[model samples]
Target: MLNFGNMHNSVWIGVDIGTTGVRAIAYQKNGVNLCDSNEFYPLETPYPDWAEQNPEIIYKATEKVIRDTANTLIYKGIPVSGIAISTVMHSFAPANEKRELLSNMITWADSRSVEIVNELKKDIKLTRNFYEKTCCPVHACYPFLKILWLKKTFPDVFSKMKYIYSLKDYVFEKLTNKWVIDKSSASASGLYNAHKMDWDEDILSFADIRKEQLPPVVSTTYSQKLTPDAAQRLNLPKGLPVVIGATDGVLVNVGIGAVKPGQLSATIGTSGAIRMLTKNPKVDKKNRTWCYNLTDDMWVAGGAINNGGIIMRWMRDKICHYNSRRLDDIDIDPYDLMTLKASKIPAGAEGLLLLPFFTGERAPYWNSELRGMFFGLSLNHSRSHMIRAAMEGICFSLNCVLTALKDFGKIEDIRVSGSFTKSTLWLQIISDIFGENITLPQNSEGAAFGAAVLGFIASGEMNSISDTANLIQSKKIYYPQKENFLTYKELFDIYNNLYQKLQPEFTRITTYQNQMYK
Candidate 1:
């Protein structure tokens, strides 16, 4: 068993604001986790193509985790040197100058801006120019399209229309009274110029928004003192340094010490992405991948799938409905129970295949019209077979991203992280599908750990950010089996063929589904 809470000296707090919720972990030097706490919120999908979370609700969840963690540190008499934050990218909401949220947080999974994106793509020159400047694809996930949707949807007479920012800026402003964003988040906004390191006036004008209406972009390591009121609420000392860490996708790589050029990070949480660090800004000419700044010198190139462990969660709660306890009252993790059932099935899932795009798709396709599918389902297939097929589908989708990422360079090592590491079956499945060796970190602390390291670096607790590389270690490695690898490769081809053939059908279904609801 891996001992994650290995004791060490020097305490710093790292807070990660995620899609479903937030987590705060206090850590010591050398990647030792001292204490942590978590709080969860809701992702409400009241309408098709709309995934919304209340910004205030998310901020309250973040504040709760940080407060709980700070109280734990105080109880232990551990004086933390500083705190850092990592937030999800492309999560936007409108607010007034006083920071009052005017709308629900439109998250990365939201595809309500599809029509706006389609309209802009008619002008290929403008769209291509925007992609070249910002390194963000013409997708609904970026605020560039979302801003257009907002302008077209909400009228000035009914809207507050004072300012616009993401949930990260919302949370940060609540804590420090600063209207700013880290470059990592800004670079992904599709309004920021990747080369100039500021907002693009051309895109801003096209989106019908002014520069002053957006948050000022700053470096990933920029920090400020926590406000007196916020500090008191969290029960931490006043004037505590709050480092504005990078996006969660970038920070996860830092957490794992996958800093070298060829070291790749494959993460599956609520969503899945394959990321690699590049020394300079890199944009895919095919518009199949995205590049975001980690620092002025470091950029992350990758693709993200809107589906991941979330599919398994659906299989648990809706398909199988497996309770967490057995008849004998023995406690079992729901995911483990699902995995146990799936392991009994063979590698190919016996002709069962799933598209797994329940919430549209990102990365290579960036198509919002694609819906979920269960193709080639046979009478022989059971819930376990379908579950395993979903897992394989997610892996196959991530492989699409990995293929685009290969353009950056040869990916020598693939490091897998997130809660999915608990399932040996899932790990082996990903390894087989990708036909690559998968390495699991000993601690897999991820974004929170990376955030704390950034806090330490920003607060002078650490001499250099490179010091973190020496702290990360690998725990176990899973190699691809030739038989299963060949099976997955054949199935992967079939998967792509199915996706290509079903495009028009998916688009038709999505249109009728939306029209019916309206």
Candidate 2:
């Protein structure tokens, strides 16, 4: 129902194929989003520390969203000019040469490849070689090790695999018959070299994967005409350009105008990420932080914690059970109420700390066995305090990532975008935690907008990606309160100390959980 203008004025579609859902949005020439439709699909967790989703499910969602959006556009008498897609990184679905799914896509959070990661560490030269080549550590959170796991454990699937593609690459190929990937997505996969901007043969050797198995590395603006079959499925004109977009995390930085060297973006979506752009590749000595190329010359350096907004949802469903109270009121979401209650509590949640590891920990702590904990809970603490603690805890975790990036380079400011940024209080709290100003985008067009910019550039409608900053603008800025900053600073120290104290306990918990589940 939201219409910016007619297709004659400006028309393009941006599709975001996320872990849980697929969304397609129509946009005007000036970057104003017209309308969007999304289709949801649940992710599967067959075992502890394992996460995955059927590629067919995602593909179906993609088809549904694009078709519905195109139908809506038809209703408005405007044919979409082109389509662009952005997706999460570190997820791969192997396929035969014809591009049929060989198995379910291995997600970034799947730690089933832990054995491979550990084995990779044993060879210091191999570890150093991969880091030097790909600029990504040998972590379980990548397709390289995931492929290795499949090849060793599930040889049938591995042998059947003729082509390897990330979720986005598969979708793009389905639409255009082109096997391609953007630099941003490729660099994060532990298969491509971040500095050299190509697949690292040495690292490929480590994984025992060949160049023939991977998708052709392409720029974000790399485009092709949509196939007739896809055009019929989506009800769009054939030959419309389909731009290759990077991962949603890097596109988020572009969407929020956080492309500057010192400015970064910290997003809290289904998962959380703290990202800053670097002209040169920056690697952490401990291999904790990941360095990914954003463009040929620019790179994104950051860390990811799989538990971000998921923690808030968990607290709402399992802890608060607010939905049970207001089952009839479908209009009001429980998470909004939780956020409202959280805003009432003062900074630091009165000494309550939530370890937000309901799905294990990433970044500084790569432990898959780390369990979520509410340290320092008391009778005096209410549900509101618990909710506040959860929110603050996620921000505090992001602060840890920021601290690591700071060790690598300078961070003068941060731009935050995501569903969580809608809460002004949460933005203020994050600013307080970071001890700096955090700006929110006026309109969160999601990765689609940035991808559209890429599409426009590819189509010769725009000059460059840097010109996108002029189109996107910030709405409000949250400056740190000195008192709240001091409060969070002291509490963050406690947060660090708690991790140190709970390390052994977490390991024990993981060991027991692993035994029980496995």
Candidate 3:
């Protein structure tokens, strides 16, 4: 039994629609967390290289979490000020005129459109032009290629869809009966022009879709009142203001208090990204990074890796199955056990190397045909060694993004968050690999806390988004070690060289697999 009378003056809620689940978090004005609740849904993979989820299932989970969190706060006599949302980017579903989903939402991890992206890449000039306009390369994970794939493969569904809405947009319509998409999510679709802050006509024409088929793009801070039905479902007041927040990547930067130039944020969750705030859109000459709009004056410039902590999850469930299950039965966290085992291994994992790309990869490579591999395995290598290599591989992959971001501006220290922070060993590995200090926030709520901050700003409880730094306190810091950095530098060189050497083989294998399956 907690005391509700001792709570702060006001509280705001942040609803995060993530890849694995939906979380509704309540935070006080000063950044103290009052309560949080989460509801998880499942990812559907009917075929290899395909990832999707039913929108209605996700909405139901969202409703449950929101209602649970709201009821918890209300029970404590806390008055909800406002609510904001943070959602995964690059997910969209076809919908009818009634805003009902025509198909499952295609997630960012889906690689079914790899063939479409390869075809688009055949025209180098056109690919470069689109990349310049949208700041997203020809990749299977992006909605631009997904749209092309859908139109080509499912003509009937394409013809019937009245609108294409991202997961956030679909949920927003359910809550408010209004079709709208934030510029941050829109910009990530590879169909929106960051410079013009509108749908790119050329890209839309290429995808064989019209502007009218997409939801209207709105600002990040755009707000609307919840519908009476939605309000009742969540047991909240009718007409409660809901702010349309930015995508998870941008909000992660905000939640970690990386709002200014020279500040970078590295978030390793189910997926991972390394992002930095910039005043203007920073486009890489090599087109290896993304520059998504965060606000009218701010842009997020960085790269994302499709594999992060997910690779560890894969190892725990598949390779270390017996140990994981045993640990679970004993009421111990399997990841903690794995990390403890990994810490006993040498810095280089005894010459073992893992690619960490179970679902292809993003950022820097943007190659969906690439697959995971474990190189330099020997008889002496144990499961613990493999775990260390996997963790190191994840760090090296994110370091690729950090190196790319350095081309745009200076990054002295990285503000870190997400599931990766739970492991001190992983944090030290990240610090050594990046050769910089890793700063952790007091509350590692990631995107949800950022969404709450946005809600506070929208409701006039906070002055500006820049106040995020003042609101968060530094919890811990991990500094790079000299010897560890040197060893990682050598290993990273091998990791980089191995990827280039394996590119042709990756393509060949993908082609053979697709042909065999067909």
Candidate 4:
């Protein structure tokens, strides 16, 4: 038997399943960490432009984190109030009615559906009509396009499949024996109606799918009890409430207290995005941004980029001789070494610029055919210059989304989160590029903490989402320097112009590469 604790000491657990890893955090109502655990899994790329993860592997990782965190709290006499979930948006796989996945989970980084997306874009009116209802652009990153790609490529799998499952839905089903999707996850699937708050029938017909084929849509606050199997695995009570939380991007805003209009929440996780909450759902006609649900009454309008910290990961593992942190015998992080070397290089990388579309961009460009490159490379440039330019390119890509949100009114506050927060040089680069002071909260687990907040509300521990603001305290603030800002502004303009001028070349080179590999 465990000792009962004061209500004030009750901890809410939030489990966030991301692209490359899973994080479970136990947070008290006062924004302090009681216990936490993390585990990483591989992103399988069997073919060019394909990104996938085994559903079983990801689920096991999630189970370990949640169990580990729950066990630690149990050992410490800290009572766990409830648990909540957050996951990457748009990760999909086909399944049987029994909810067995037909294949590995297709991640957002996969761009195999570019041809289908291109075909969809050819119909301007139809694309606009779909965007009006779904608030998703005609892009390869969405599940709708992935389904089309699957049908065309793997007819056998498509014929055998009876249901579609997002990553969160799979985990929820395993835990509670229920298959359902939160509104935030469904909204980004490119088949849910943001206005009507359900599956878009027109898109259903367009995909030759039915409402029955997708999980029932529910609120982020929806809660279920753990099943006998899940209860045994986690060593928690069977009746423990498991709140279905929002998607990663939206939840990060909630975690950082950037829930108001004009308050921007910028994230650079496995990917990057710039988001702001709004009272109404809005879509960009230019197809530069996507809008999704945070709650029935709230919407998140923003843009996302495929390349962020992953670029740094590539520079570390592929360019540098260092092995992955886990596999390497070295005591230091390769990222820290890269940052230190990059800080020594002057801004602008001595006239060299890199376009960070390594995984194909999402927001602003929404072009999967785009490929990354270094312009103005010369023998004079060294490894330090190359690293600095790569980091600058990532900030430049994020700035593209910030530029699109100009219609959201001038940003009242800029708050950022993710692993990138630990690197002072990277934060300074962001601050200088945007010419604004960026603030970091004491708690960096934005998505995970947001899920915990939902758990609190669903379990009747908290009254409202807005109550989260008071629990958090500002940690550090990075201010832009005048000289660096001026230099970055000029480079930003050049970055935009370069993409415009070389647009055709991108399409051509991508076509040749695809033909050769595939």
- Among these predictions, the greatest TM-score belongs to 4
Indicate the worst ten consecutive residues by lDDT in candidate 4. 1-10
Cα lDDT of model 1 by residue, 1-518, tens digit: 11112123557788988888799999886788889999988889888898988888888888899899989888988876677899988987777766577788889999998877877888998788888899998998887787778878886612676788787788888898888999999998999999999999988888777898898998888888789999999998777878888889988888888878798999998999999888777888788998899876788888889999878878887899876656237766778778898999999899888999999998899898889998888788899999899889999999999999888889889988887888899999999999999999876768888888887676566665566676888899999999999999999999999999999899899999889877
lDDT of 1: 0.85
Model 4's alpha-carbon lDDT is 0.88
Q: Tens-digit lDDT track for model 3 on 1-518?
A: 11122223667789889998889999887878889998888878666688999888999999998899999998998878777899999997887777677888999999989988888889999988888888888899899888888888998988888889898888888898888999999999999998888998887887788999998999888888888999999998888888889999989888878887688999999889999988877788887999898777788899999998778878888988857556778989989889999999989898999988878999999999998899999999999999999999999999998888888877766899888899999999999999999998887877998888877777666776788877778899999999999999999999999999999999898788767667
Q: Which pairs clash in the backbone of model 2?
A: none
Would you list the clashing residue pairs of candidate 1?
none
Global lDDT of each candidate: 0.85, 0.80, 0.87, 0.88
* Candidate 4 local lDDT, residue 340: 90
Candidate 4 per-residue lDDT, tens place, 1-518, comes to 21223456567889989999999999988778888999999988766688999989999999999999989988987777778999999988999767678899999999999989888899999999998889999899999999989989998998888999999898999998888999999999999999999999989888888889999999999988888889899988776878899999999988988876677888988899999988899988587999999877888999999998888888887787676655356677778889899999998899999999877789999999999999989999998998999989999999999988987688878899998888889889999999999988888789999998887777667876777777767899899999999999999999999999998998998889889875
TM-score, predicted candidate 1 vs. hidden true structure: 0.96
Off by over 4 Å in 3: 1-8, 322-329
Off by over 4 Å in 4: 1-8, 324-330
Pairs clashing within candidate 3: none
Give the Å error, residue 504, model 3.
1.0
